[model samples]
Target: MKHTPYYLNKPDNILPKGLTNSVFRSSDPLAYHQSLKNYTVTPLLKLNELAKYFGVKKIFVKDESYRFGLNAFKGLGASFAISKILEKDPDIETFCSATDGNHGRAVAWSAKLFGKKSRIFVPKDTTRARILAIENEGAVVEKVDADYDETCEFAKEMSRKNGWQLVQDTASAHYAEIPAYIMAGYFTHFMELEDSIHTLPKPKIDIVFLQAGVGSWPAAAAWYYLNRYGVNRPKIVLVEPIEAAGILASFKKGKRTKPEGNFKTIMAGLNCGIPSLTAWDILKDSTDAAMAIEDSFTKQAIRELYYPTGDDKRIISGESGAGGLAGFIALMTDPRFRNLKEALNITAESRVLFYSTEGDTDPENFKNIIRKKK
Candidate 1:
């Protein structure tokens, strides 16, 4: 629904010196991920037909649905943070966090993996299926009479009072280390892609479209590419639902800011009104652009991935998962985005990459959307 260019005048090929030594840039995270017995690389799919349809050189989609068998990418952050916490405090018995859906389930799954108890707080609007998913992960689910941000505060308070570790993705002055570890854990995805880069049509990707919620995941991506490629890094675009486009609002204001929205979008995983401190710090300087899209566009993208062109593999993307591709489709097809398209240098030779962050996390909604006519 909206597009805004950011950091256009910033010089290219220069390393963000502040982030060069950050956890996201270190090899430790990737090494840690590889040490896990369950760790396996997710597929980086080539969509030649889709590239032809969009008139782009190529399109690569990282299918995160296969990650940890949790059907979402949040497990990467949660597992890493929990593992690091256990290393520091092995006596810790319980962990707690808040979520719209995916993060809480991830925390639960990670806690279970570590043989610790988990208490997950979720917004009142979270779907029943997601709640059951968290419960199935062996977490005690608490539905708060509040939105995502308020629920986060509630969970933090509960964790403090109960002597439980708060495994939240967002960072505050009092809590930065765990969030950093979580972000570092997300580096594994990029590392996996790097290993397979030799097999791609091009060794380097021209652009990357990353979907954001509280911004942690995309921040990890931006930090990785910025530190690794320096001035030659791919153009990174942040995508979010227009109703909860906190990252985009922050981009326009040139500082951290919250957005006011009805919070009824089908992209439940991206319905956060606040941006994380660590994420904002990295994204504000590193990313190329921010896009806010409507639910209709995400639905269209889900259908497009499920029903692919030619022999392209089918990807089961949820509302939030399809956001990156949704943003790409909007830029290419909508006349309103022509200027931004040109501004980002999107052309027939541009090799674009997208992350499908989830796979039908909300099964019923995904089914209904897929059943509807395009």
Candidate 2:
């Protein structure tokens, strides 16, 4: 089947009533993170030049490249989930998980920090840099000749056989609480973003563009914003690579559904074929719209961030990290996506927010893309 870009607005009839504030009272996993050495909040950069280019009032990006020194936001979730798991079973000897890249590294890092052994599984096609990064964190790397979804299954089996604590980010009927903790851990980013936003002169965020893989990050963010702002919550747009736009497919079907095909995309971090069950529960009713974009758009967005035109600050965002910017730029510049722009009410006064979820996680690929253009 030929993949085409598409957008779908959430049906009003199915929109969720606001969730209770109590849900977030003890939900943040940041307290454990703060206890770690050298912990710091990532920067919320205001890209005035990009705002001018897009004809928006403001554009703020939560740069998560340096999160926990892991170079991606995945550390927050992995660390939080693993920490919580260890609290219950202090004698747990091993931890395990499957990843496209960043999440595996986070799991390994957390394992190392807690003085536990870890075994991480990755797809055959995973980049060498990512595998090496995971190994450097003291985890045994197991390469499976399968796609990410298959690797997840392999990891699950391995975890059961070895009695290792599984820290997978996606949830199913059999394994829900751990993934919920993973999602809860992700709240740290939003909590930090909220504090940063309050420091701004104009604190109102009009629209939020979040990129989705299995949908955990966006779900966590959407939940935080929905509860924090309630009726005044900003419009949320979920962006994903066209090849693996599982959440987009689900939204289009008006229920959860998996995307078809190889699920390969340059945005490897977002190359998930299935949406996390817990994440889907939150996004199904909370998101305002969903979008699928081509790999070329993400490439262009990387270059845009690396060498911005006008006075925009240079941002070293990786392919997956730039997907939100790619979707936002597509809506603003591409005639084909003009309707999506209007549907999201992207007016001149709109102040948009995006999360740059990673940096140059794959350094060689980052250099090739940014340097080739130069």
Best by lDDT: 1
Cand. 2 TM to true fold: 0.94
TM-scores of all models?
A: 0.94, 0.94
The RMSD of every model to the true structure, in order and in angstroms, is 2.5, 2.5
Backbone clashes, candidate 2: 0
lDDT of each: 0.85, 0.83
Supply the TM-score for candidate 1. Answer: 0.94
What shift in Å separates residue 134 of candidate 1 from its native position after superposition? Answer: 0.7
